[model samples]
Target: MTYVAVALLLGLVILVHELGHFLAAKAVGLPVVRFSLGLGPVLWSRTWGGTRCCLSAVPFGGYVLLALAGEKDYLAAPLWRRIAFSLAGPVANLLFALCCYAAVYAVSPGEHSLAGYCVKPLAWTLGTAQAMLAAIPRLFGHAQELSSLVGIVAEGGRFVGASASRLLMLGGYISVSLAVFNLLPLPPLDGGKIVCDILVRCRAGLARYYVPVSACGWLALIALMLYATIQDVCRYLA
Candidate 1:
């Protein structure tokens, strides 16, 4: 039951992040091709408001595809719209974290005031974001401390088993982590996408290389995930 709950919670976070991008694209008048909750082969799909919503076989990650097919197509959109589409996913995760933190405060046994409910959660969310930013540099120094989704789910299961409050806290932490991770200035990440878009817009000559750069980014990201998973498995075994 604990593992099941953790899985569901993780899925919800991914869903929320993708939903943010989908909504932002729609708001900016960009045609969305698909909104998928997972990756790889589609298990089930249905068209809604001209967008194909899909559930894929893999449960670890998700994406929102715009109607654009190539670099020219993507660049045709307004720069601000592209930036908004990129930013929305991380912003959604942050807001979800805030809600989770608020829930944690609400459920705790205490003489909570209106200000307490409002201020404490905001403070905690900001604090968590700050801590994550601070820890980013340390992660490079302490690569072994890095964790994959496997480790995250395992740790989350433990928290869920401890108590409801701890579960909420865990959820909030994971949401913030998701937001921060996506904001890293590496290729294929939201931050990376934004940076590339801005650079290309400023220097149209760079447009030709976008696809190759993005492909390389995806390769690097996959390699990192595999390495992290191996570390998680070895840790569990030890």
Candidate 2:
């Protein structure tokens, strides 16, 4: 039951992201006709102040539809407001992460010592020398262990220093990760849009070359992922 509650609470963080979009769009006098939590078909809905807010059938993602936001006229509004609307979702995620961290630190408070290996700042270092003294080989480069699942197994059962703090750190890691991923200067993504904006304002000719280069870079990344996945599967089967 508590696990379910944790999931539901996490859902609120995502909802807050959509709310940020709704609020920013409304602030700029944009027509926000549909606000939906999750994707696909609507589960339930309400119309308020000319906005049709609904809960959708899918649960993993959500959106606030600033009416005509994707169309040409959406650009009729002020440029600053448009940028603010584009930025709101990720800003909301950072705020939600702070709240999550607060909840975690409230439970199982720990010290910055070796005993913290069972407590926390599990590998805290007072200075450079201490950090060097405590350095240990990691499976994934300074990564820390976090949650425990009831029916899951880990490589070599190596959860020697797992704790709530580590788990919360992982949550923050994922949130920041998304922000970083979204900010990458690639096309078909927020970062790409920003890059396009800059390139248009700066060099008109080089922007022509950016698109093909972006496509090739994406293809390379996909190939790398496929190679890594195949290696992982082979290793697991072995």
Question: What lDDT is obtained when candidate 1 is compared to the true structure?
Answer: 0.91
Best by lDDT: 1
Global lDDT of model 2: 0.55
lDDT tens per residue, model 2, 144-164: 222122111222122313555
Per-model TM values vs. the true structure: 0.97, 0.57
Each candidate's root-mean-square deviation in Å?
Answer: 1.1, 8.5
